[model samples]
Each structure stands twice: as structure tokens, then as C-alpha cells.
Target: MPDQPFSLDQLRIVLIGTSHPGNIGAVARAMKNMGLADLALVAPRCEVQTSESISRASGADALLVGSSLHESLDDAVADATLVVGASARSRTLPWPMISPRQLGAALPAELSRPEARVALVFGREDAGLTNAELQRCHRHVHIPTNTEFSSLNLAAAVQVLSYECRLAWLDAGDTAPARQTAMAKGTAPAGEAPFGEAPFGVEWDNPPASHADLERYFAHLERVLVAIGFHDPERPRQLMARLRRLYLRARPDSLEISILRGILTAIEKHTGRR
Candidate 1:
């Protein structure tokens, strides 16, 4: 049987701390051009519906009007099963990084799961995503550009990624069944196919944990770690960050998260903190 074509609707474009109304409009235009409709604005500095934005959006004002507003990045992507942050530079701690094309190739299999939502997050125009913000993503997507002139406009960056996603969607519609079969059988032709990659290639019995679920687990884990005197809140090392990276890379499912939480509860009971 043929696999179902990946739906653009399963993907959402999240703009964090966007300062310019015009850029927001242009982003809407770019999304519409690529057949993507979901737009999330997190702590936007400018109004979503403005004359400048409408003018820049050209004919894509519907997207701007329908866009969801979020108070924080976490709120915006709380329900997303997969979150990929767009970053131009590397951080002190390395993250699982992939190129825009690789990201495009990976989306088909990712969106195949039931109720799975993927968020493509773009940061501010001036500074880009903060270290804390990037840490929330499961993967970081970097667009390879010339070292001498690597600066990219906000809307232009969105356009580039949006184009890649549309290309992937079209390709999946045509060859998903064969490609998926080959991947399941570990016979996919190598070279830029992103086949047999961690997280993407693995089959799951339970749905991948949502961003909200992971956040709650992290909070619970932190409390338990503190209760057990295993982690210090002040004058401490990067213990939490490292653990976060570990679990994010693992991409634990809902059932796994539940089990982990249960363990934390048992630890609290044993520690006499409950």
C-alpha cells in the first residue's frame, strides 16, 4: 500500500520576537506561496495586522489575520511533537544539526505519525534565537551560506525553508510509499536521503511526547534531582542542560515519559519528600 502524502498542514512556522511588521507580512506571503497556512507569532514586537504588514504580504493577508499569538516560545510549540530551530551560528554545546535539505527530507516520515505536529522556529531579525530558545528544539537547522556574506533577511530565510518544505511535500506525494518501504526495510539508497537516521527512521508504538509533556517531565526531574541532592541550583555546572540534550536527542515517546515520571514519583516517595 502507498503511504499517505505528507500534509503541509501538519507543519507550523513559528516566528519568535519578530520586530518588524513588514517582515511578518512577507513571511505570510512566503508561507502562502509554499502552501503552508499555520503561522505562530511568539512575543512579537510589532502588531500582526498593520498597513505595512498587509502591504508586504501582498495578497496573503488571510494568513496574517489568522495567525496565532503566543506569549512565549514554549507556549507556541507546546503541542508540537517535533521542534526544529533555525540557527545561523553554533553554540558552546553542540546540538543535533541538519541542513535545510536534510530537514525537508526528514519531514515526510516525521509527519506520518498520528497527531504529529512539527514546528519550524525562526528567531528575531537582529539577534536570532537565544541559547535557551534553541535548547528547546529537538534539532537545529542551519542553512549553509557563503562565509563572507552569510547574512539573510528574516522573510528571505523563511522563503528558503518554505521552498524546501514545499519541494519535500511534492516529492512525498509522488514517491512516499516506495521511499517509506525502502526505509523500513533499510534498503534506501544512501546520499542525502536522510534514511536510517536516528529519531526519524525508528518506528514507535506510542506517539512522540509533545513539547509540553517534556517540559513537565523536565520540571519534575529537576525537583526530584534537587530533592535527592543530586543537582545544585546555584554555583552549579551544566547538568540540566546536558540531561535536556540527552532526552531531546532520545526523542522519548508519551509512554516513555509517563514511565520516567513514575520513576521520579517513586524516587520522591523513597526520599521521604512526598
Candidate 2:
């Protein structure tokens, strides 16, 4: 069988509390243009199953028809291994923020996992996501806009993010064919596709850790920090914030996470947290 790209399928475009069904349909169209299909709605303010949505969807009605709906953001992204929330404005408490391009670059490797599910979450049109909703995401993606009038429509944001993701997927598939051919010398037959070189053909032995795994790790880390008198829950400074930035920036795989947790356990043993 020919190699199929599962990473694209692993991505979910999640719309939360979308006030306009037309925007939902427009988003469906945008996702379709970029070879993305999975769509999830979280507590949509308007009835998504309406004629207005169907009209706006153009030929991407299948996405709208098959899209799943949930009561809350948690439920919408319950099965997602990586969740990235899209926001236009800065928040009071800074989350691990990245540009859409950065997110696009990272997703190809992340979705290489066997059962990885990535959710690109977008919030309501009026106010965007609440502080509580934004906290649920592992990373925050900011779409850079004009400083003076930065009001971006919901569907337009989806289109921009979707385009970036498509480009990233293409980059992941791109190989250095000329370099491989030069190295092959006389061994390679005429017209034969050059073998992928270096990082291009490497397989992941340990899949990237899921969001659930990270959540558990964070909980354990918090407990350990509290036990070691490093992070006092009462008078919490930027210790946890700095740690979150460090870990999220690293984006550790499963084996790495296991090693980290093991080290934490060793610390716990010394701290008498049996």
C-alpha cells in the first residue's frame, strides 16, 4: 500500500462557542482547502445544523455533516493528545505561546506518533476564549495582526492557520533528493527515487507523550516542588510558570517524559513522600 499521511488526519479544527453558523461553514471550507477534515464544535451558540451553514460550506459540507459536538472544551478535546488554543490578544498569565508557523512546524513530528490526535482550538467571535478555557491548552497560538485594528474574523483565522499547517505537512514530506543521489554514486539505478537521507527517514522509537501523560507529570511535578519547599502553593511565585515554559518548549517524547518522572520519583523517595 502507498504511504498515507496520518498526521493531517490526526489534526482536529475545534470551534468553541461560535456565535455564527455561517462561520462554522466557512471554517469547514477553509479546512477542506488545506486537506483537513476532522472538525469539532464546543457548545456552539448558533445551531450548526442549519441552512445558513450549509450554504456557506460551499462543497465542504461533508466536514460539517460529520463534525462532532461537545458540551464543553474539555469534552471536545478529551481524546486529543496535543491541544493548541488560538488567541488574538495577550493574557494576564502568560501561557506557553507560539506563532502559527511554529505550531505548523512542530505538528508534523508530533503527529508521527501511532495514535496522536492534535486539536487546533478557536474560540467565540465576540470575546474569544475565557481564561479557564485557554488554560486547558498545552500551547497558545497567536496570529499576528495589525496593532491598530487587529480584529480578525473567526473563519479567516482558521484559513490562515490551516494554510500554515498545510505548508508544514509539505515540508515534512520534502526530502533532499539531490544530496541522496550524489551520495549513491553508481549504485543507484537510473530514474530511481533517491533514498531519504539523515533526519528525513528516521522513525520515532518512542512516540511523543500525550496531553494526558503531560497532565499527570505536571501534577506530580507540582507535588514534588511543594514537598521540596521549592514551590509554596500559598505564596506561589513564577516557579511553576517558568517550569511550564521549560517543559512545553522542550515538547518531550514518551521515553524522555518517563526518564523525567523517574528522576522526580527519586527525589520524592529522598523527600520521604512514600
Candidate 3:
């Protein structure tokens, strides 16, 4: 437990079907790093307190001592009110996802609500939470990742979420909000200004694009739009805004956008050759 205790008494780190001893140990290290102390094991495939786990834990032995053993997940988090199942992809179970920041902001309210205890649940290394397992939790959390290659280590996921909860706990229950300043009348910046977006508005961090890339994207958009009958020479600007919106929505990753421009060049060549 942290000196100030940021979590509900029912807070538990439940690992289901964990097959690797080192991962369990790493999880202990991760939890301790973020000031979380409770751990629960559910149907683990290996010895939970092996030398590998202890060694990987680094210096989190105190938290490891109280690690609870459970034959099943239901026993592990049966008393928890808010159960967040960490996953990399969607499944049959429709668990709504909130980003780490959103989770941090919302968890304190959820944990403080009457009769609700918050618990963060992690799945095994080989396989994550099953539909049956996810149903036990009130909601699911998707860790956003590259769609093409979306895989993450189990312990790393625990580290991210535990950190979020700890932050939320600190922000919600802490009493010392204002600090004295050297000014005539002290006042702090509003709305946790430290985390807000750009004051003038977030422009392209990398200036909208050079003229060349912009023209290339326009040509690509024009080709695709004309092929789909979304554009006409008489009213070229009619679909310009809509085309821009498509690219904005796609957020066409660098590679995808580059490939799109290449195809546009190829198409222009073939059409002009006629």
C-alpha cells in the first residue's frame, strides 16, 4: 500500500492462467513500481513463487509475500466492483474501452462509489481474457496499438494500467490542491493545464506536409474520387472538403499514404498513355 493509500481496500491484481514464472515476477515489479501491492494468481501453470519470479521482481518481495492463490478467476476478483480486463483486440464480448488517461480520470469516481471496489485484471502470456472471463468484468480496455502488428507483453500491460489507477487515486483523494506562490494572490493554472493540447490548437506537428506531398495526396484523392464518381471537372471543389476529410479520417499512416500516392502516379501514367 502507498503511504497515502490510493486504491480501494478491494483493489487486487488478478493474473489468470499465467504460464510464465518470470512474467508473474515482472508483474510484481511493475505493480510495486507504480505503488500497487496486492496480487492474486488464478490457475497459474507454473510455481508462482519460484526463483525466477522472485529474481525478476527485483525488490518487490514485500508485495510478493501477500500474493494470493486462487483456483479460479471468480474467486480472484469476486468482490471487485470495477473489473478492467486488459486486451489488445476486440472479441465477442463487447467491453467498452477507455484509454489509460480516461481510465485514470474515471476510476476514482467508480472506486469511490458505494459498494464498488476497483480491480484490474490481466490475462496469461499465451492467451488473453476469454469471453467467459471477460464477462466477469464490467468493461474491457483496449490498449491501442498498430493494427498490423498489435501484440504486447502481459507484464507491460499491467504496468500501464496500474500506473493509471495510481494516478487517478492520487488526483481524486489528495487534499492538497493549492500551493502558496510568491505572487500577490496565488493561483494555479486551470484544468490541469500541464496535460492540455496546444493553446492555439494542434496543427500538424510536422507542418501539414511539404507542397510535393500535399499535391501527391491531392492527385491520389482526385483519382480515387473520379473513379468512384465523387468528383467532376465542372465542380472540382465540390468534393475537395470531403476528400480532405477522408484522408484526415484515415490518418493514412506514412506507409499507407505513400503507397496511395504511388498508385495514383501509376494510374495517371496508364490513363495518359491512352
Q: Which candidate wins on TM-score?
A: 1
TM-score-based ranking: 1, 2, 3
lDDT of 3 by residue, 165-214 (tens): 77777765463232223122434333331111221122222222222343
Candidate with the larger TM-score of 1 and 2: 1
Q: What's the lDDT of the predicted structure labeled candidate 2?
A: 0.79
In order, the Cα lDDT scores of the candidates are 0.89, 0.79, 0.65
Task: For model 2, give the 10-residue run with minimal summed lDDT.
Answer: 192-201
Candidate 2 residue-wise lDDT, 92-121, digit = tens: 777888898988877655665558788999
For candidate 3, the lDDT comes to 0.65
Q: After superposition, how far is residue 27 of candidate 3 from its true place, in Å?
A: 0.2
Cα lDDT tens digits for candidate 1, 1-274: 2445568899999999999999999999999999999999999998889999999999999999999999999999999999999999979999999999988988877787658899999999999999989989999999998989998999999999999998888887778677677878888776442222344345556788999999999999999998889999994488888998999998888989999999999999988996
How many clashing residue pairs appear in each of the predictions shown? 0, 0, 0
Model 1, residue 208: C-alpha shift (Å): 0.3
